[model samples]
Target: MLEKKRVQQLDIPSREGYDAIFNSNFLEDVPAALAQWGSSRVLLVSSKTLAAQHGDRIAALQSALGSHRLANTKLGVGSHSPYADVRDIARRVQRLRADCVISVGGCSYSDACKAACLLAANLAPDFTEEDMEALVDERRGIADARPEDGTPLRPRACRLVAVPTSLSAGEWNALSSATNARTGKKQHFGGWEGGGQPDLILLDPELAAATSPERLWLSSGVRCVDHCVELMCNPESAEGRCEGLHGHAERGLRCMLGGLTEYKAAKTRARGAGEKQQQQQGTQEEKEEAGDKERQLLLEGVSECQYGSREALTGLLIWRVPMGPSHAIGHQLGAVANVMHGVRLLATPSPSPHSRALISFKTRPVSNLTLPPLQITSCVMLAPVLRWQAANLSNPHYKTAQAKTLAIFNETLGWREASAADAVERFVRSLGLPTTLRDVGVVSDEEVRRIADKTMTDVWGGGKRQMEFDDVMEVLNSVRG
Candidate 1:
């Protein structure tokens, strides 16, 4: 925690110079910008939720767009993040022939608008699935591996303006993330040529003013934790946290705790009678302090949690410690656990990867994690799973089912391996994750070792650097501990 100059500063597009700053539910800024541009046909873009709550405001924005209001589309229902859905949205935009697309709402809605801009600007290629899938995978994780030759959709890019509701930071980034349904992986576009970056951005707290304490809390935690985790995993990154490097990790941790406090306070206020929007009546310095606090927490603790917590900012250019074997295992568990996607990470006692402060969470929130929708047919899993599935592919009986479930179980509780040695299962029982490899279906310590040996090398990315076979056996042995 000693280096100094490495800091991941949030990019502020307001510095890039925009003609107008459209506040939330921007029915207000529409008229002035349109009058200045002397353009007709101001198309309104929104989502189903947004169309319902703020449709009148949007209509007002449309009217303000002046006489030439050609057409607009509200996109939701489909995962706008998926490339196929984005393309569909793009086709709709093309048919509408919008001059400009104003994205309203969170990252998902904004992303759809960005995709549409590409198609309209002729910065994209044909809507082939393979081409789209190839593009999405290249942008999934923490790197820039885009091709120089580009691809089919390179020609149809467009200039865009984004209005973000959450703190995913897409407003400042030049790239957009979409999922490739074919591969079930997130894809990145822009950061080059036509889709490189947005030409303008407007951050109106009022946009976020619509957020709920629960969602705000979740999104806040997600963003702050993501920043913290990314900073820890990539201490050497240009825009990374500074623990050994500086006090960045500490600052980030404070920010996290700070945000938690803010949320709790806001929650209390919201419950009492105050509106959901954080009181904006405070001084600029106060707001800035809150923002910094949010940014700091993001820079610290986020790395300790797994990838799921950071899902809100999925495709944005944030540093993320790719979810390791534990997270993958958790995903498998989440596929069946009664908790939501990221909550298991909180419950699991992850190894301390951070070089900073540790703040205890106030409450153990109830998670809706469950065992459905998680068709763990071909995921990277702990080793016994490899052994069992191969050994008994046809058995849908409880024994096999339990064995398969064990892989997700042991990993969640952080058992070295599910064993009968020390009643380690007792401890996990305290936390509630499954206790034995046998609880799920793992048969022996040998099987545990085999699984750990495998989990550390699963291709989806993470590996157990120290949790080797013997380590896995320890967990299995710990079933008694």
Candidate 2:
């Protein structure tokens, strides 16, 4: 118990050089990025859908680089960063002798391209499919693997520039997930040789607004919220290590949540304008203005997510604190259950019965820190406690070291006296996200069981507050509903 009160030191992870630019029509900056990366040959990795939508921009980039320098374009990349796809992409990069890789579209394109860049830099020229998969599998989220775990692997040979269109924010971290071809489970890789982090990130609001359904943008904002909350709650921060005045976690949460709220408003306005257009009430000019408004709002949201991504990655790099169970289970949900990554994070879930029981037992002898027992139930409960702390707590830094928690449930979801779990459920409902496992398309209890089993082995699993296998069963049973 006393050990829990002490702040512990953490090893800083290696972060390579990179640049980020935010503006509309910033695709023009690609050539400059290429130049900064010192690449004479460039490969553009994007999806066919994006190519069709932004053909002119692609053409312009190629024109800027001149046809001679543009090595090749690989389009129609798959989602979930499928293992075979990445390997194939790597082979293409190697064959073309591309010096820089540019990823467009969303998480899938960027993740696949990042893996390809890493492989092109490190692997032997004649590496086989079996060899690539074996290496990826071996380094896939080994918990104890650090920069100093051994000699640093080869520096990435090809530089990467990520241009994301959705809110997945995979480009911001030095880690990417690729699905294993055999089991359909997503495996984590990168961070060893800074293979995951991109050399440059371009945030062009107009491009981000093109994402359909508007749900991806909104829910992925919640995923950023999850990242900030966990970093704040992590009790692993050392006393003097980067313990500066800046509150990275709190700032991150503020940016993410505030961005989501603004984006929601913009989406509502856009829908209204579209409906008006359907009714033939709004003029063409008004419709254009509405579209521009939505685009600007989308850009704002993306920028906020980018800022939060920096803070989250900084915490991950400095503290080396394992990602909380929410991330662990969310990855499994994406890989095993086929739920989209953002949707998995946004899905409303009930508290695991075993976790509830653990909280009850632990809080039986209440202490002065005012920690909420029910907050232990699920990751969705993060918002309320954080809101409470921001409003009530005096300490600038959340003293998770002394209390082993930062959660202190108060009014959230606009509810006066609801439990944290209930509040979270209601909040997620307000966002129109799935409220249960079945709602997100889980097929069976056995599938949920399999996900729970695999989650235990995830690199992010088994943290100080993680639910064990039996506890995971209780959660799965609730999700089965």
> Pick by lDDT: which candidate is best?
2
- On the 0 to 100 scale, the lDDT of residue 274 in model 1 is 34
Task: Give candidate 2 regions above 4 Å deviation.
Answer: 1-16, 125-129, 136-140, 143-151, 192-195, 211-213, 237-246, 277-298, 340-420, 463-465
- Report the C-alpha lDDT of model 1 over 254-334, residue by residue, as the tens digit: 344344344444444445433422644877787667665553433232222211222322222333223223333322232
TM-score of 1: 0.51
lDDT tens digits by residue: candidate 2, 447-471: 8887777777777653224557765
On a 0 to 100 scale, what is the lDDT of residue 295 in model 2?
A: 66
lDDT, residue 177, model 2: 72
Screening candidate 2 with a backbone cut-off below 3 angstroms (N, C-alpha, C), the clashing residue pairs are: none
- Give the RMSD in angstroms, all C-alphas superposed, for model 2: 10.9
**Alpha-carbon TM-score of each model against the true structure:** 0.51, 0.75
